[model samples]
Target: MTTLLPSLPPQSTLLTQASQVLMHNYSPAPLVLTHGNACTVWDAAGNAYLDFTAGIAVNTLGHAHPAIIEAINTQAQQLMHVSNLYATQPCIELATQLTQLGRFSKALFCNSGAEANEAAIKLARKWAKQHKHPHATQILVFGNAFHGRTLGALSLTPKEAYQVPFAPLMPSVKVGVFNQTENLDTLITNHTAMVMVEPIQGEGGVNVATPEFLQALRRRCDETKTVLWFDEIQCGMGRTGTLFAFEQVEGVLPDGVSLAKGLGGGFPIGAILVNEKLADTFQPGDHGTTFGGNPLACAVGLAVLNELTQPAFMATVRDCGSLLHEGLGQLQVDFPQLVVDVRGWGLMQGLALAEDQLAVGDLVTHARNAGLLLVGAGGNTVRLIPPLVVTPTEIHHALGLLRSILGGV
Candidate 1:
């Protein structure tokens, strides 16, 4: 993975030029990343850091993997963008793979998790309007659930910081406690068009949904004819040791599910898998995207899927994921003054910090300076999501780095 782009200026000069031109949407770290391999990345200053953030869980296969690079190069040489009006082989093949895996009949492609969740929202609402009770237009979402920042997805995301600037969101949204079974029975009703939930709340402190609560939601959705949707943007695509995180829990299924983050291995592709019930509910003109199912994205998506769905690769994820989870759990016990709790499945984990310790932002900055990248989730959570291809050695190295940062090891 040699440098493909032209090298010119130092980190400070490059960052200064970027600041002059680029928008201030994101507050990035002081260092500028140049290239990466496996779970390690190099800054412009030539310092290498072990990456546990994995670009916020978007880089499924890690940076500059041979397969993903080949897919990108091959697709660039052949075809790139095609409007949704026409069909492409890559699109067809990728959709087939995803639908077959989810046991769904159809898929709607988009460019991000927000768009995928938005598609799910529209499909559920339209289905409710056409078939279910005409008055059934309410939507149920859990607290601390992060779908995306898009208007429709943001409306359901109940975080104050993210939703404060954008007020007057969609109406009829009833909030339910995630993993709380008692509140779900009464919170969801026939008036609910959709009940959107995350298998594990990634940005919301890595809180996992209880199997009992999921089963209860499934039963209630069945009884009320409401479409059950899962926002697997951050937790899906083999991150949870399954094709879909919901698969790990028996007797629970979704009418539709949205996917995005790792689908194309950081190539920016999204999709919604709708079961047979709402498969035919969407008409041709109901929803569409111009650049959603383009050939380049689909080709990369197919390549990533080909790599991820392999039996051997999945086994590695399970083994490596368990090791990572256990290491983090041990960290919690080792630093009770700093760590409040540790929770998650597979590699998508979180460590909630004690109020007495440093803020998550400061801790993340300290960890970054120590040559280990970590991201802060909502609340006092420090998120750790390494690439699926991360090795046992890399996991141990990351844990050691974290321990060193916390004044141990």
Candidate 2:
């Protein structure tokens, strides 16, 4: 048997040592980053990389923004985490801000996308049962969708590799084609609990649902009692140059929205906002969390909300997003063989490769060597979700790096 190791090892030696100590859950890249500044991170080796992944779209304001640091420091000095029984100003204010933007009646706080989704699933089933559609426990999800890794979310995930080993997933989940409205009609019936969708699917190769499709779903959900839930954990929080990607479409609002990632601006937080009619579905004893909605996380979440809601800030995202999209569009013209398609809304962008997934890896690794970090998804696509605060200069540089790599490929 391998000998046990200590936990206080140096950062340089941590990965190797931790591999033996910790559970093998994830296959992280071989870089041990020690610290970071806005839109950039430095490994223990002092190698710098422009962060295009943005902590998988978690660091919305980028690493260590001055305002974020100040908020966290001040909040920590005063209060970190108090029990949820005591209401904090930050928590109250954030709820107010979120509710103001939409028709959501109440916000239930949690600590991750998976947990928020779990809460949503439970709430949906309970609501359906109470409404007398007891058999309406089936949830309709899309192919190539990812909600989280928890059992409920994993059960909804379409990826086989993440689910086959963890068999015996929660039952009654039906899979449908994303952006295919006709298929949704066939799958969703009176027995369907809820129809969960991602406005701009982040992990599913950044596929943005057509406006017609979302409108169709919204109409159908309204007619039927099936709750319309949007898993905006990755595509929401101003990533699409708006508070939520659904806003991009006219007359399409979800009954509940599952949020995380950018909402806390790096601090771990998740929430599910339910409309007025469905808000009371859960009774007091129905659900609770020990660490969810703690003061520290709420404080950071408020800070992120405040900064992201600024009109000027959102305008910059729109401008920068357009520039990046146009730049990538131009690049696609020259390397048609390398780029099968380019899609995504705002900062949640992706490049579909003409070749196989292996070639996408080669291109991504080459990008890393050129001082840019990227993440890939299913369907041979590489995501380019840079920090929302990324400057045009950085975008141009990143594009140049991609050009060099694509030219070679």
Candidate 3:
């Protein structure tokens, strides 16, 4: 790959300008990233780092993938943004691909995971009003679940810190303990409009929902005529060695599924896939977005799906995931005092650190300083979400870096 470093202001000057202009919502790292290729990114100061974060598991093919870049450039030149009233080929084709892959009857495109989840909430309310009682509007979500940061999705997320600051969130929302199948009957009732959950909770410490628990939720939702939706924004699009995390569970098909993150590689796109039962819940004008299904985003999304759905892509994901998991497990064995647990499936793994021994943020910072990037999740866990196309050599190199960090600690 050719490297053409663009002329720019000093890193310190840029950081100061960003602090003055941008909001203080995020306390970002000091590095000013310039460009990337494969699994590595170069900062403005010409410092290269292995990107294990993969933009929080959004970069399906890593940086500067040929397919994604071609799609973006080609679609931008031909057609970019048009109103939702006008249909585009890329939008229609992308929807067809998603419905076919997910075995869902229909799809609604949006610009982000939060919007997809918000659409699901609206669809559930409308469906309940028409089918169930008028007051059947309660939504049931599990604890430690992160749907999104928007108001509707935030209400579903039970984290006190993220919720308390934005008080008086959406009403008619109920919380349940994740994987607690014993309380399904009490949690999901006739008045429940929808039951949304993450098959593998990403932000909530990479928690995996058991197959039995999902089976119970499916049965109860059927009995009460409630919609069971899976928020696959973080775990979908080959992140979990499958197209969707729910596929690994037996007889656990959801009524609806929300998707984003890796769907468009790095381009922003989200969608809501619904089964035949709830396919007709949303009418033509029920809900929409201005730039949801724009040609450029859909084109890039199609390119990403094309690459992910290749014959050997998923098998490679499984193999790489096993390798990564093995490395993490070895770390647990080597550093029993610091690494308390290693959990998660496929490439979306997490290393839970002992709070008494070390802080997750400290470990992440140490890794970053040592030319590796990592992200911290809930429960004092450090997420290792690398690109799906990462090679064995890269995985080993990352493990070596992590081992060095742990040894120093």
Candidate 4:
């Protein structure tokens, strides 16, 4: 264990002040985080914790990377905000770069994953009405898939726990079994407009879609002339040790892709990549956003893409990810009773507990107290999403902390 840091001022006053103003939608930890460096962040009380969550996979290059900070600073000085009515050079440049990488002809920018996905949904719906069967309005999504929080996205997310509060969402959403090839055939009827899936379901417990299953879905979508969409919001942008998570599964490509989370490396930015098939789906005034393609966000996104997609950087990620995986595998062997499975691709891995009685939340709480931070996913899974910039040494350190926690338990 590391040396205990000095205690700072109480955060009760801070929480009390925030409760008066901020909405009660989120249940944030009591600690007031002040600043972060690399994969470690210090709370207001001067205690540092190894950040495995990586802002839920938003900080691709880790917190406050010099490149991201410099890009934000430079763009802020030049031009910060501009309406979408006026074209910005930074946005155009970023779009061109993203198109080049994603094999898409066009791109649309947005502020968050939800907006990006919403754009995809709208584009798919438009295509269905105009191109496919007019009655084809059904959006097919998989069970345990989390697209986003918007009503359209929520309609596809079939989790009753999240959906009950906001009942009566978008119509004709067909929910199927994720990674189960047999179940998808029934769901993809003639009325199916779009089939949206995550290459790897991040919030749904790091469940990776089998390559065969994806290929089958691809074939079906092609046969039905339905738009295939991949929600790479959490699993894309080098999280899966590749440019896109779908790249890992060969012979399977989505007509549309929703990207966000790690795209801007901490800066809020999202985008949809559309292939030639759906490139012309959205005409002017079809769909838009006020702060979608702002210069500052695009500048940061460009910087993040440049750093993350480099040959050396990606090679390093592969090596570090291997190390982390090996360590986790060893941990699974060491504590088989506790760990049910360690499954995921690249840095987006998870440790699913053996039973509900284990309580993944309690493990996360204990890990946080031990100076290592983690987040829980569905299926009683503990997610380990350290920044892609994580080194081999850092990986070992994290494993040590995790082993210590497990040993104590």
Candidate 5:
């Protein structure tokens, strides 16, 4: 005989129950979000919040967009998953569009940013061994970089706190200073198989790479014949007022680009786009994923790409970004003691706090209490990454809330 299950408890008790059963990996806020629409989300207690985090920059078109919803519903009714053994129309079409948009010759799908970086790592190593010397296997990364938590990706992310527990990570990884073009020659050696850098370091306090720095890296990589890769997981896919962040930087392009986060607009999907030079790096059995290119995920990805590629949509992003930047600048001027600096491009902006006066977490809590959600990055910086569809009115309201919070503090 089968045992009957217990009834669900009230919404208020959900967090308590979660604490008992779930692992303590994430310390989420107290609010239990029920649903969302556009840039607004409502909790179980019926309180509405203007979401500036946008699910950590994963919700490209905002929550419950009609196109995303429709694509998911239609694709679910028809096809969802089929192993990579057979090809699917949505997968093929999405790949084709991505290749054309990213100006890459090939694409490899995966489940998350970590997986995409892992694939790029493997491809870089393999290509180096085949085309270059077999001993050229070093992977060069930068300081204050946050790639992902997976072993291979984690190895490249030079954080003492994240790496202390997981000792003995993947070997042959070197750390370099970000945006310091002076010492690039010393960092990237002939044995270096690949050099991975985030054009804009997200978790590292929105540290944007200078165009001169990127150009220097490209030149050095060419001199050493090393694969140049970019981790655009958080800053790519129209977040920076362009399809790719590299578009803003002239005379620089990566041999491979790893993408995820907003690619599927909330649906989980990751991909690596490689130029023709490294197009055939991965053989048939070299890399594969069970649910990477499933019909449902690819369908959602296509819908997101469709909306982001619209000329009007991208123009709106640029206009609103300028407005948001101006608002943040005003905040800095108003609260000179609290707000130290403001930085970032497009909709991905950050306000660096005066840590001596206010901590990032305290400011985040204040914003949440005032019905606005924000995310914190390194260097005491609070990120304001609202959806690409956020309006000027919502931005004004968010700024108003922030002004009130700072005034009250």
Candidate 6:
């Protein structure tokens, strides 16, 4: 069976072959990437694209960065995997660095954003059961939110497109309007175990949450004793200029934070950072994973985190992000019909198209053809989640290509 298939298909046939062989889950972009350099990827056809999407914001330091390559190579030469029974240096070091970043006192490593969110859900429920209320289990999730695809994470995701077939999800999950301060009061009851939200709504079209809203949530959670979980998978790890998006706001800290995407700089690692009190919920035998804290992944993650945490590195991100955001907003003034609004913070930006103007997928496909990789999000938005390492010059080049495409559209 293995020998029957071609080793690799040509550029023209790759998409078609993938359709026939792979599951009908993702509506992938048409470009078939052959290799990637810093902030740029080349298609098999030899066309280069300024990667604004950054593999959906996973490649924080950009593709094939020298530091990342070195870390991965050095770790591969030493050890790969050791069971949770024995502690590994990379994992211990990475966890210590993450713990120092904020009020989070402990870290639970996983392999993806979904897995991290799943761990958060379990920790939240377990904490509630043991410390707060034995019967408290309900969780409050926001509308248009995307946590992950796994069953437990899926339960927290409210999008119908991701939930329809997998009906009868985990019980006691409620949907609340985002940024609505009053809604939290109604949604959070004694039975609520946790209230989950993204600091800046990523899949929900880059909507920024007001500090008032977060402050309200913090107050409500304090009164109700509910665990507050912030899903920072897409927007964390310097994707939003800051190490975490919530850091920009005053009095906006969560009891638990789930992070992935950019944490490994494309090496694939996720984590749940818990406050000191909530850290004790998980006992030894309660939760575990075979590949969670492997040395290779932790080494890569450690490098990525170290690079992103530098003050000078984040200052560059802020400058670049400001340049990109202002450039796009100015374009909105010229092409008001094609673009309704441009909004976001740092490199995690988005352009919302006018109602009934054009499908978001069409814009994404057009950008790919023009050698600029972009991704679409909810509410007819085209997300511009470039790598944090992207420079002002790269942002200008990418936006210029987008402007050229917009003139034709």
* TM-score of every candidate: 0.97, 0.95, 0.98, 0.97, 0.97, 0.96
> How accurate locally is residue 175 in candidate 3, as Cα lDDT from 0 to 100?
94
**Residues 1-409, candidate 5, lDDT per residue (tens digit)?**
1121235355569878878898998998987787888999887666788999999999999999999999999999999998899899999999999999888999989889999999999999999999988898999999999999999999999999999899899999999988888888888887899999998889999888999999999999999999999999999999989989999999998999999999999999999999999998888889898998999999999999999988799889999999999999999999999999998889999999999988999989999999999999999999999999999999999999999988988
Best by TM-score: 3
What does the lDDT read for residue 58 in candidate 2?
93
lDDT of 3 by residue, 305-392 (tens): 9999999999999999999999999999999999999999999999999999999999999999999999999999999999999999
Full-model lDDT for every candidate? 0.88, 0.87, 0.93, 0.89, 0.92, 0.88
TM match of model 2 to true structure: 0.95
lDDT comparing candidate 5 with the true structure: 0.92
**Model 3 shows how many backbone clashes?**
0
Against the true structure, candidate 5 reaches a TM-score of: 0.97
Off by over 4 Å in 5: 1-9
Which ten contiguous residues of candidate 1 have the minimum total lDDT? Answer: 1-10
Write the number of the candidate with greater lDDT, choosing between 1 and 5.
5
Better structure of 2 and 3 per TM-score? 3
The candidate scoring highest on lDDT is 3
lDDT tens readout by residue for model 6, 143-170: 8888999999999999887888999899
Per-residue lDDT tens digits for candidate 4, residues 168-204, read 8888998888888886667887888999999899899
At residue 97, give the lDDT of candidate 6: 90
Candidate 3 clash pair list: none
Worst 10 residues of 2 by lDDT: 1-10
lDDT accuracy of residue 17 in candidate 3 = 92
